[model samples]
Target: MEAKKAVRDQIISNHDIAEKFRLLADLLEIKGEASYKIAAYRKAADSIDHTPEPLSTLRQQGKLETIPGVGKAIAQKIEDLLDTGTFELLEEVTSEYPPTLRELLQVPDLGPKRVKLLWGELKVGSLDALELAIEDGRIYKVKGLGPKAIERIIEGLKSLKGRDIRIPIGKARELGKRIVQQLLEKTDKVEKIELAGSIRRFRETAGDIDIVAASEHPEDIIDTFCSLPMVQDVNMKGENRCRVMIEGGIQVDLICLPAQHWGTLLLHFTGSRDHNLHLRDLALERGAHMSEYGFKKNEQLITFSTEEEVYKFLGIQYVPPEMREDRGEIELSLIHQLPKVIRQKDIRGDLHMHSTWSDGKCSIRDMALAARSLGYEYICITDHSQSLGIARGLTPERIVEQRKEIESLNKELAPFKILQGIEMEVLSDGSMDLPEEVLRDLDLVIASVHSGLRQGREKVTSRALAAIRHPLVDILAHPTGRIIGSREGGDFDLETIFREAARTGTILEVDGDPNRLDLRDVNAQEAVDSGCLISISSDAHSIEGLYNMEYGVGTAARGWIRPQDVINTRPLDEMLKLLKRNRS
Candidate 1:
């Protein structure tokens, strides 16, 4: 029970961390100032709890600095928390408001700005104060807070008794697409509309909808948007941009640009801010002015009618939204240029997937047919092996049957190649689920440790190396299995895993599952540095999950993976040759 309580406490603390960062980040974004830096902190805090080493343990060991993205300032605060029982930065921030204000900020529909509004404008700092202030009818009169918004705020406050569904990026995109379609129907002035930022790049999770539209009449666009069924409250109204709070407490930004400004608007709103900033600086250096209106050289404005023109004027061939993160792309893009974006057609096959034979919701035949229909040249049906009983792992008998089914399916669909495979479990003893004979027969093998996750560093390194060095293993999937907002897996020396994987001609998978975008961007870069051939797989359990593969691709590109570096980008014949050549 004590252990349970400690776990509960830890979970609560993590919740606070995620909530504060998100709330603060949103407030900073809405205020439209220093957002990228605040967003970096929020993104860093978002990833920390997913890290295996307790931020506490790392801080205690004076190694919080080792975590990617944490940096010295955050690390020092983490260290302070380890030495004391509280986080100094959080404590200091909360001190400016009331402690309860921090808790109140967690309520849906409320943000740091709202709390700041309540504190500064209304002299209401805490929930109790807000309640009293609301009862007395004072909060409704603030500059940004009005009656309808306040009423919705209180409704959200009351609804906190129930849980709201936090949606995935794909689902949010579907909803946003629906909204775009509706607006398009309402006006022919709607020249272009697309999701920008991380959603456009297919991030797993998302905060809000960023909708940009190029139009003839901006007022009609705003009217069409506010006319949408999702909008519950219009927070701010401007000719160019409008912030509307939607149902489920999700915020959506509708930016309407004159058709002439569409290119600049898209380029600006589609920003990975670091990338935009560097581009802005570059425009300055080249005696060009860069703005949402487009790039200008000298005193004259050079606006693009399309995003392509914007990039050309900036002298970058074009930087795809996925590659925007200011991670040294500017320097490379300046030297020799590649195509601005990766097309869906470029992917030759879906390399990592499960079937009904394992945890997947579909059959091998169904998945293969679906992939073929989607223009894939090949599909590998990799079921989990016996060690993962929960996934209905294939026993040796099942493995034989599975191969027969694949072979039969291949015969039926003669043109499309089928790779018989297993997401084999690498047991704690460093033995594989399928013995040597079964592994040799397989076209591809992925060995992953799903259990014994508590084994410390050396054991994890050994298990990973054992999997990589084994003659049959081809790729290691979700090596860490660290789920976002959940328990973390043990630590392995990633440097060692990459070195071993490289030497063994094994690939390391960057899992695309939103909940488990394992071997995250930083680790993927580390793998690249180690000369490991990287593969981005959805680790797809469902057909819908397969679509999330682009998230892995996006994360990979952010880590600077070129087309030549990813294995699945290979055509069927070449991929087969590579696999067979590396077959041990």
Candidate 2:
């Protein structure tokens, strides 16, 4: 009875519920399910995911069906999942398509149809089998599996190799913050707490979480940390440090020190190893040795309460944590010439987002209200264009209607403008989806490659370059098309694309989606270095997603992008004048 009660009491978050639906949708698609059925499941999943309230609460209130895209049938499925952890259709579906096949979906460029083809034709049912097929060159014979596609699969598999060990930066930070919050709220004697290490540096992925704290009673804090509900097992405990395995097998180490040592401790732990080595060499040059406690100068100990003080003592400008990758930041700091990277507050608007008109969970007014709450001066409703029907892409007629709605919202929410825009698809032949006349009159046009991402490098490059050269197009969104751990970006000559964008005055995007920080840091830097203007945007699909701007800005900062480098940082009129169509 107690076990059953505990099971019933288990908290299943909205993300958990949504993931099941999404996985079911993918598996059903691989089973050759009807297009409309697959779309319904995916849509329901998106709605559930974006919902701010807990579905369990909604279910208790019998309001699950109230969610957009979730009808009576879907509501029952949610109830079944909540009650017993699985539903009949999910069980039946997994039987038809081996659950293992779902793993293949994680491989880049291998969507449902491609996975079905490989499974049916090559019997590539598992990652090992798929790898063997690739090794034996058997995948080459699969009708739709081209050489480029196989290369992407190879790269995707390589990325997944160690994925289970580390979490993405967004998830890691979220978890890190939660742990820190719990400690501060529940524990005693913790004077200062900060997340440190690679996570602090805003790396794309993190292995273990590092947290540093300052306290006079370090042992009390360490004990409380080890006993937290999230800590699965305490691996080691010392006077000043404790290492524990958290709920998901993620290792977290808490290093507690005297309050006076925070500056040096944070600097030592928030390191790239290479960065610390450089700092150590610099300290040696000054007749001192560095440690987490402090620098030692001629048998005297020096400590600081803040990072800025430590840098000041070293006679260098303080390097932001995101720039602490030892990528010549120290040298630049010595010269007092570090780039003033773009910050969250510097952004004036978000230009690329979706709405209910095109697979977004929120209405235009709801999305606009959410943006207004974030202090954004403006946002462009760049819904997917006509060719991408899966997203309910707007037809020319629908776009005309959308403009009417935008104009209404712009007036209602006076001063918070909504720019009517379209995320026009760059089709397989390098021709854009919308007619030129339709695209020309919009407030903004974002040309993106949504299909045929597996084309060879030259073809893909041409596709992208053609879009960049289009006079109506103002920005190239998520130029790489990579999904972090899930997929590798398209193979394109980014140098050529960047160069072309520079010449054409087309802006390149540093997308803020955690999963698709396309034009990843290195590429964003290269794009900027090539003299291309940048736009940092949260390709947010829901209001909660608007917060993803921080991730994008972090990526841009790592690339050394400054506010002046990002066009959206400018005021609305100046920003308009900078767009390709408006540029004199």
Candidate 3:
């Protein structure tokens, strides 16, 4: 148990150290430091972020510099962090500049350069100070400050003030996974540990994390959980349950029960509250009282170790956690007709991803190898078209060049195919960036709107419709270009677009990028109902990004999507046939 705690502690420490370095980089940039120095710290932070092994282990083995982007100096800094939890350089930097000034950077449009200007000239060290400066018109005197910039700053401040406190589901899962792994390793008498609540259901955002464990020694389990290094505040301590606010200010509740009552407790706690209520009503129809402990039938209590058994006792088929939202699962479960929800394993390939031909960090062959590693039979290299120059979008000549490269690589990587494709941008006037001649030569085309998002609904809808109706286009990438908590998606009639997509055999992407899970759960559900085929794609730029397919599958499951509803669930030949059908 002690050893397990040490591992968990090490993971937390590594993340903390990386975050501090990142903050220091931002601070250094604000201090007008050399660009190379800022890049060095940022690179070190990125290396630490991507390293799978614990920093402590790497330090012990003297292999910290083996991590990509980590050099001798950065490796030494990591060692110093592990040893003293602080370093002299970071201390020296923070001493000169109050770290609170970094908070101003969180305001949108306020980069390090602007922050440095404000802090140096007007002594604006915090959001409140900036707000005062803006209100008093003193901010206008700063060079490059104008009416439009002031308006944007005010808007950013308003957004920060009203920002949602809930954490994204992906982040919640990562935290919950770490905690569950530690508990599984450290607890002696534990039989099972499962995450419950909205997190298990794969909601887009979660209020807190709930964990249920089956153990013979409940007291010991509670004690170990409360003692975890991440626990910042213990709100409640009891025999069977303990509630703690973790390091990130997210609350987590741990419930320990005997193995016999594990299933009922998990089901009860893993609920969309309304779904549980509906289940209880169904139990009442059978003259049974349902609760977390068990179901009471005529003065006799029945407890089950498996969720399937509990569902059988209720005279219904088992409902998947993601489908436990009270949208319609109860009615389907009652009739034993619940849809076979799509699982991560059902995915055969990723249809939308970037490569070095555009903005991606990895090369075409490297991306292909990474996809193959994930058991994918194929992947599409959907690099941006020439309109998105910031992403190094491919010109027509470059597209032809990339196609030849893919063809050569495809011959070498035989069974694993790399489908030539482009994420062609739809211009404001409803025209695609790439010409028909170039698009016709590709195996797949993902038509997307990358600019002019502020157009009216009619303009946006017409633009999107043109792309959907294009013969060469296969999928609509991020039908709505939303970044959760950052920006709202473009205003277009989604239902109208869904209808056209269905008619044209065009697929709408359920993009897997955590920042842009566009055609989000609700929108995905609507598209499915409209008979539009959906593609759950990662839009991966790096190898690590490929794993984001799991998050996409979770979103699809939340939308009640079945395996058959997702086009990528089909094998290579079938997917190609469908793509061809769309073209036809």
Worst 10 residues of 1 by lDDT: 7-16
Q: Which lDDT tens digits does candidate 1 get at residues 276-377?
A: 898888888888778877667766766777887877776777777767667777787887555343345567887789988886867888888878887888
Indicate the TM-score of model 2: 0.87
Superposition TM-score, candidate 1 onto the true structure? 0.69
lDDT (CA) per prediction = 0.74, 0.88, 0.87
lDDT of 3 by residue, 181-270 (tens): 667767668888888998888888889999999988999999999887677889999999999998679999999999999889999999
Which residue window of length 10 is worst by lDDT in model 2? 1-10
How many pairs collide in each candidate, listed in order?
0, 0, 0
Which of the predicted structures, 1 or 3, would earn the higher lDDT when compared with the native? Answer: 3
The total of clashing pairs for model 1 equals 0
**Model 3 whole-model lDDT (C-alpha atoms):** 0.87
Clashing pairs in 3: none
Number of the top-ranking candidate, with lDDT as the measure: 2
2 or 3, which is superior by lDDT?
A: 2
Judge candidate 3 at residue 35 and give its lDDT: 79
